[model samples]
Target: MALTDAPVAAKSAKRLRRQPLWIIYGFVFPAMAMALVFDYYPALSGLYLSMTNTMEVGIQSQFVGFSNYVQLFTSSIFLNSLWHMLVLAVVGMTIGTVVPLLVAEMIFHLMNGRWRYVYRLTFLIKMLVPGMVVVEVWGYILSVGGLLDKICHFLGLPGGSTGWLVDQHTALPAIMFIGFPWVAGVGILIYYAGLVAIDPEILDAAAVDGSGGLHRVLNVDVPLVLGQVKLIVILSAIGGFQGYFAQFLLTQGGPGWSTMVPGYYMYQSAFVNGDMGLASAVGVFLFVLIFSITLMNMKYLRSSQDYAGQR
Candidate 1:
């Protein structure tokens, strides 16, 4: 009798503890509605808009199939901009991905004391400044007679008074080299977290086996932080496509489209030229490209993770 009654009371208590479905829905409804209205609606509408002949608001919109995309691929200016964007993306990703990992390794190998904290803080402080401000500052720096000018004069190299940002031959390269040394705070933080989270015994064991600094870093440190490296690479790739704010704000696609990226091209099409359909088409292309790259990166990261787990 006691056991039967105990089980009955436990079940009753569990039933009593469960909340009503309406209450859960009440908590979730607002968020779901917001997502549908703000996120999904815009995405779907943009997709629909990309296929239409919409120029601007108050203008007649008509379905025109893939004409906008055809126009985009056929335009020499757009094609040139695409080439420039590719160059920027490749250079930016290589520098942005590799440099932070190196910086993180340097900081991680430092004596785990005041110096480590100081160094970490020094890099992370870059995150304090607004991203827009950073872009603007770099824009100024790359402008005529900016910081690069002084450095060029110091090094006895010919510094163009017209600035690399405006020179047709150097505009893209200037954008590529904006963040000198590329010690991005976010990358440093992510890589450092991965490094610190590593088991100390693994590193100590490497040292015990007569593994010196370079050997340990090459074999142990880098391999352990593969996940972080993968993450930064994906982020850089996505940023490569979407991160054209600098070009938009400063260069304005100047010097005959030397620094123009697809993102900035989209903005120029939609806002400046009032070609809504064309801009939406560009947006769609960028979204697809970025999505594809992210998926590939994720797949690679997963396989690497699996391999690491096997080892």
Candidate 2:
């Protein structure tokens, strides 16, 4: 009787395991389907399209091999656009990462809840404004005879009436500044949440050890929140590289392509010039660059965490 019951029990256990396996499959399939429909399918289609010469109005496409990529490499406009993207990536990362982290840290040290709530709400309002509206508003602010110019004039500064966006030398930086606050607000919120997650007891202990303010922040707060910083930095770098809307709406990649970025150039290639192959190649390049940077950041962050653990 015992031997017979053992086999029956084994069969029941097998059936139990199979039930949860099917449940997991049922839960995972919808997400997989959505990924294929939205992401994977488009990426695969783009890859195929990038290898062919597809005309704007024609139904026929001819295989062009890697000619599109070769042409992009030889194009001075594309090269310059790529350079502008690099500069934007560096500048945006600085503005998006550092400014927000500093602001969050300062706010974290403040004892007043009302002031913190006010600042948080202010940033939230700014973030809630439509991107197009922000771009348009800033375009006016940067224009000659606009509020910024009037303020500068009031201060008695030379070139106060100059339109920053209309100059090749300052066009990209002006657009970057317009987008900076939008990107920085997200980072600030992330850092603020991270700061709140820190243990109050740990902070008290640091204070008892005679570490005050700057020393405590540098030693205790920074290490604890390093993970959030890493996430913000990686996100900022990606946003910087892909920044397009403000530049497109405000400068139209101009004052001689000074405000041009990879996304803007890609749009011009595909839509304006009807060069879908080259545009797809540009897209692929951006994907690779962003992927590489993200991986490097992850590795460095993991290493830092390991070192902190040792200490």
Candidate 3:
């Protein structure tokens, strides 16, 4: 090619590459706007508010410079709420991760395609139900003379009419029992997708080697889905630390703070007690805790091919 033609062709290629830059920015603009407005702005504002003694609106609250955080750490009520959050995180993460993996494995092994689809549809339907509706149904089930009491009546057990959400000893446990089976629908789908991604030859080799059932699951399947497990674990920990929907709906952190989780405590501080500064401080603490734990997990408990290679 001539030198002039070469330069022209190069310029044309550069223009073509630059042409799509505007389209990319156009597509990304909406998400960027949303993050700035909803996520980034609120986070920055909350952090600033946490350092002040702001309670009521329109009155200039003086900057207290970490006093809110100090109070949060020293308060017995906050400490109790932190403990409750930790327990819920542990229990929820355990059942949320393991149960869905088991369910997914069972579905993956189903011999009939129709039956497998039916099972998947059923799990999906559970997820279609709104979370608030589920909490309300559980609240009714725990109410006095509700389904629980009827079950106890069938067994001739006295004191079955006890108020589950109103008793200090039972409120937190009752909140935890809302999703009794604990096989989250989305979790099942994720694990199943991970299992489905495995090469068929790998499974055939396992079967040929006489590795099936529990032996196959522990040695082969589990390692294959470690990525899914790690994903669910991280998600569950974040949700458990931030979630208080059930506690708020069913118990309202009642029965003398027995069910007071950190999220609800923060809510009460802001909306109920008019202590926005403290609530903001709690929010900051929760953000740090989740960020730190997630970083540690990503650093040490990586979901990589090393374990799969070992297997």
Candidate 4:
């Protein structure tokens, strides 16, 4: 009986070995197909289009070969808009990354219960609020006759009655402030989840060793949550590069284009100016920038452990 079972066991083991390969292909194929359809094809098409002079109304195109990219550098408006995007990326990343992590860390120290629930719910609600609604709400709040202006006037600040979003000097920063809370609220939730996953014993040990409050957080909690911080930073950077909706709704990239971002520029190129070729170039540039940043982030932040080790 044992000798007969040996052959059956061998066959079963062979099938098991084959099963995983089939499963791997099965799982990978759908994702690969989706990427080819939605991501890769569009990207390749855009690269091809960038070398041509394509207009919205025309079905015909003339291959111009690098002229669109060359023209980008020569156009002062395009160059200035690109520069503005860089600045916005830096500023947005700073506010979105730093503030959320700090808030998460503070929230973590609070005894987990109703307070945590309430705070988390509040942030989630803020996230659910529409971007346009938030922008318009803040627009009213920052207007010349808005609540902030009245408060500033009461405090006797300079330009107390001024419209913050209409002033070129403050417009970009004001728009940034409006957009930031939405992004930061999401980041806070991510970090909060990360904090919850941390081993409680480690924190307890730190407290027992007389490391309390900020010292304990800076030394122990922060290091342990470095992975989460890295995630927040990379995601925030990506969001910064892609940010435009609030600025579009609120200032319309106005106050002398101070709030202009790459996304807005791409939109204008594609629709308003009807320069599909230039828009494709801008799309390609954004794709490359985002891809490079993501690669750099993964290289620096991702751990070296294999699947078994992580488990």
Off by over 4 Å in 2: 1-30, 112-118, 160-162, 179-184
- What does the lDDT read for residue 198 in candidate 4? 73
Which candidate would rank higher by lDDT, 1 or 4?
A: 1
Better of 2 and 4 by lDDT: 2
Q: Residue 61 in model 2: shift from native, Å?
A: 1.3
> TM-score for each prediction?
0.90, 0.84, 0.87, 0.83
How does candidate 4 score on lDDT? 0.77
Each model's C-alpha lDDT? 0.84, 0.80, 0.86, 0.77
Sort by TM-score, best first. 1, 3, 2, 4
Sort by lDDT, top down from the best: 3, 1, 2, 4
For model 2 the local lDDT of residue 191 reads 85
Residues 1-311 of candidate 2 have per-residue lDDT tens digits of 11012345555666554466778989999999999999999898788777888857476888999888898889888899889988888887777777887788888888689888778777777777787897898898989887767877889876534598998887877777675445337777888888887889998999899998778878998888887778878988898888788766888789888888889988888888898888888888888889899899879778877876696
lDDT of 1: 0.84
- The pairs that clash in candidate 4 are none
lDDT of 3 by residue, 1-311 (tens): 11012345555666555557889899999999999999999999999999999998887898999999999999998899999999988889998899999999999999678998899889888887899999999888888988877877889876445678887887887788887887756889888888887889999999999999989988999987787788789889999999999877878888888989889999989999999999999999999999998896676455364555576
Q: Candidate 1: deviation at residue 181, Å?
A: 2.4
Worst 10 residues of 4 by lDDT: 1-10
Per model, state how many residue pairs clash: 0, 0, 0, 0
Clash pairs of candidate 1? none
> Which lDDT tens digits does candidate 4 get at residues 86-154?
887787777876788778877777886888887878777876778678778888888888877887777
